[model samples]
Target chain A: MGSSSAPWKQLLLSSIEANSHLKHHSYFQLATVSSNNRPSNRTVVFRGFQDDGDKILINTDTRTRKINDLKHCPFTEICWYFMESWEQFRISGVVDVIDGTTPDPLKLEQREKSWFASSLRSRVQYVGASPGLPAVASEQSSQSPSLDPSIGPVAAFCLLLFDPHQVDYLNLKSNERLVFTSIASDSGKKLWTSQKVNP
Target chain B: MGSSSAPWKQLLLSSIEANSHLKHHSYFQLATVSSNNRPSNRTVVFRGFQDDGDKILINTDTRTRKINDLKHCPFTEICWYFMESWEQFRISGVVDVIDGTTPDPLKLEQREKSWFASSLRSRVQYVGASPGLPAVASEQSSQSPSLDPSIGPVAAFCLLLFDPHQVDYLNLKSNERLVFTSIASDSGKKLWTSQKVNP
Candidate 1:
């Protein structure tokens, strides 16, 4: 029952603060379950996180394999590497999908804008009107909308919320590995003691 | 039948050149097979690559789970991500463990020095008297000549070499994903072109 004031807690906070660019780090290696329960991994960008550090948010297209996997199995592990320092942070947690119906409007707007900016609308059209859709080519050829259209109302996007249960922080400087397990109780949030593991 | 001058090849060459930091970017995600045949991935630093991009090398301790898995299944996939930009490269191929007995003295020296610097002799002493053996508390009190020495010599330091068979280059900016497969012949001395899958 150690408090969050432990050295490990400070280390985690300082690491993230010192490496502020990690927030905008383009890709994170995401591990998800496949149809047969096998694991598959891909890189995805980091969106942001909550102020309380209770949850982290990421954006992904609906067409991606990870989105489909998240629909089935919410358990996931995310690996983030800092290129400059050769430090790594591994987080294992449960993922929750947040859609337009989410309570917070600010969160919804941020998610929508990010998704829209990352969409492949122009490229999708260049590839010729969605491969499988039959009638779309004819309709598009008849009266095509401009290439750079406004974010349409029909566009659908979602935000993924990752609540970490365990975080393994490894610093290559001293080849040191530290594991921090986060537990939330009725009183408040508490981080257990850190264990030094073999690197 | 396309030549190396194809768009994908140019794209890859340009990406590698533009992102010069990538060559020095140490962290890479490595996927290895577990006992259950499932894939387990973790971060490892990139040591170097061959002149022709034929082989990629990584420094690993014999005690790591990845090295153990490689003993059982030599097939692995390495994912390299450049955080500053949305560029990622995936290399899947067979792994060859190169030991100190390797003919190339330069490679041997590089591997040994990497392991020595990474060992942090202080922590190695805490682990145990024998280099590879874990230090037992009772045996910890016993003094041995080996105890004063560095673990680099006795440790089974090996270089994990991955000869690329398939490569997937993804540039999120242009929404372009390029997949290239290579065919190796003559004991990996010569390579041939294979089909390029649509990305």
Candidate 2:
């Protein structure tokens, strides 16, 4: 319950680094609500961070159903469980979409550099039809648009710029449990104010 | 891509069974949208099934925010990732809360049996203050209501009776990823209409 004293962001970054060093191959479960109000979740790999590490960056194809979900409702949440430390981090907030049509030069530059640096296999996902589309009957990721070396990043490649208003960090790494919330302050400076929460 | 031939229900049951035999600590990430339309998620153990394996069952304390979220929206979603098999299942639907106020005699009986069958350590969670409430500054799961043996089933224990209308099952264990959608028909017979979809 003394989670307030701990630097929440620093702890989170260290947890991620530790998990990666342990070869956890971990992923976060990203949740979004549909226009009809139903909740949907899927696994997403952590790509990077933005906005002074206040925003999380995740890649997706523009044509996916999740992209549509975000369009309808910007409020989303992500949950990450650190296997090595038995810790869990939950972030809830809104997102800004960065795509080919994005106006910001800095974001556009980041996208270009990241795209060129990614492996060709990873870029294949951006080559074909959007994720939720009709597929021909066959074996092997029939609808993954296929892995073709000739494929390059298409206009569908986009990034989700998550702006978190609340962060719930829970650690059960010991006999005791610690739960805390880092919320955006009313000060409007986007500073995170951390407090102890009941575990 | 040949997911069309296999019966939807059969495949799901087999996948669950396979995970159990493989000693996979498989859990589902349950998501519920708050009144403000923000989606939140946490991990829940795959407890059991109701409605003859159609409706999924999960246990929780009445004081959790998720219960309030369900009361506000009723619509929820769960994502289960099978580690060894590299398969994922997403279920989205409404939920029926089973507690002292439930009208169904069968469900009440099920809750009583499940509670008594659970271990003392598990039952201790039901003894605590509402999940979001402040806790006494102390050690060991502070407001986890304490680990006193005298604690019994308080008014907090409840069952989440999930009525899934959409089931999206994907298998990435092999080179080919199989994506299938099983939607409940409008005929009211609970018949699942299955189809192959783009992965």
Candidate 3:
């Protein structure tokens, strides 16, 4: 089965697997366009893949600059760098927000837990509260009340998903460099096109 | 007289130099938009920087896929990864072809040499030429065409100059992450706006 696959497909699968395996350790720099046409990029944790690899998911507090940028402009691009190998992978796609719901309760739970853990610090950082303040400190002492009924509903935030239709892969070897591109149609079939450029 | 500067200005100057220096290495990635409204990104060499310190130049041949994408769209984003320190810098701006007769000779020379020196191996790799040839000779013969003229110009052969308006810096530490943004105006004034975000 593996041998039957095209070279581009094989390379893509390997690269994606390598990237996803390094999800926890990888820092993804995501760029989103604002309504004013300016682009904004930030470092985000790679939450995981979804829709059978058709979509990539990331978790972030809804209050962050990225979320605001996404709201203004749904088009975004993401870059993942593997320093050890001097390899880089870039994904550009449309951003769609998804709330926790049916068809994947376990996935929803996992995402929620991750969000909670990640947001514990965000709550303090955004409000200018001292890091020394306890998580359960008084509402005034804390940036915002964690248990605020009014904010809780809006707080269960998740960056729905961004699906890349085009991806570029670059590998820098000691003396040679390789570049390839994969473009997928809406039906999910991918057309692989590649060229080597002067490095 | 231009040597001494205030602490803040000095810091800015040093950062710009450091950032430009990092791009001189073997690999870097740039994000551009496609006609289909999707984002396209690929790795390109860090050709060099301009004397103004306001723009960065990258080399590309006329036959590359990215050039085709750019012909359809000019808005682009770029991400630079510093291998040793795990530091990343991202910029979003408009990409324009630099005219050879522009006022700055230093910038022109740097870019010209970058394009002129792109390897023959890179050209073969860019065109997907290796796969069509026999396996045995492909590996060995790939190195023999270091001087072929066909390797010089790909579709993406023009020099890409990024006129940046904003830059985001991310530094990963053992326990904490630092994130900040700096914006430059037309008047050559740069203002830094920072925020400590949760890792």
Give me the candidate number with maximum DockQ.
2
Q: Which docking band does candidate 1 fall into? A: incorrect
Residue-level lDDT tens digits of model 1 in A1-199: 4444434445655666666665344457876655555445677667656554657777644445666677777877777776546667777778877666668877677565655555555324332332212233355346544444454323335568887777777877765677777666688765565566645
Compared with the true structure, the alpha-carbon lDDT of candidate 3 equals: 0.54
User: Where does the lowest 10-residue lDDT sum fall in candidate 1 chain B?
Assistant: B126-135
lDDT for residue A65 in candidate 2, whole number 0-100:
81
The per-residue C-alpha lDDT of model 1 at residue A65 equals: 60
Question: Could you say which candidate leads in lDDT?
Answer: 2
Off by over 4 Å in 3: A1-25, A51-54, A72-75, A99-113, A116-156, A164-166, A174-199, B1-27, B68-73, B81-87, B99-110, B116-144, B148-156, B170-199
Model 1 over residues B68-152: C-alpha lDDT tens digits? Answer: 7787778776777765566777766788876666788776775666556554543353344332233355653465324434545
Docking category for candidate 3? incorrect
The true-versus-predicted C-alpha distance at residue A73 of model 1, in Å, is 5.5
Question: Which wins on lDDT, candidate 2 or candidate 3?
Answer: 2
Candidates, ranked, lDDT: 2, 1, 3
TM-score against native, each model: 0.63, 0.85, 0.61
Candidate 3, after superposition: displacement of residue A64 in Å? 3.1
Model 3, position B82: C-alpha lDDT score: 54
Rank the candidate models, highest TM-score first: 2, 1, 3
Full-model lDDT for every candidate: 0.60, 0.71, 0.54
- DockQ, per-model, please? 0.14, 0.58, 0.16
lDDT string, candidate 2, A33-88, tens digits: 88777898998777766645666778888887888899999989888877667777
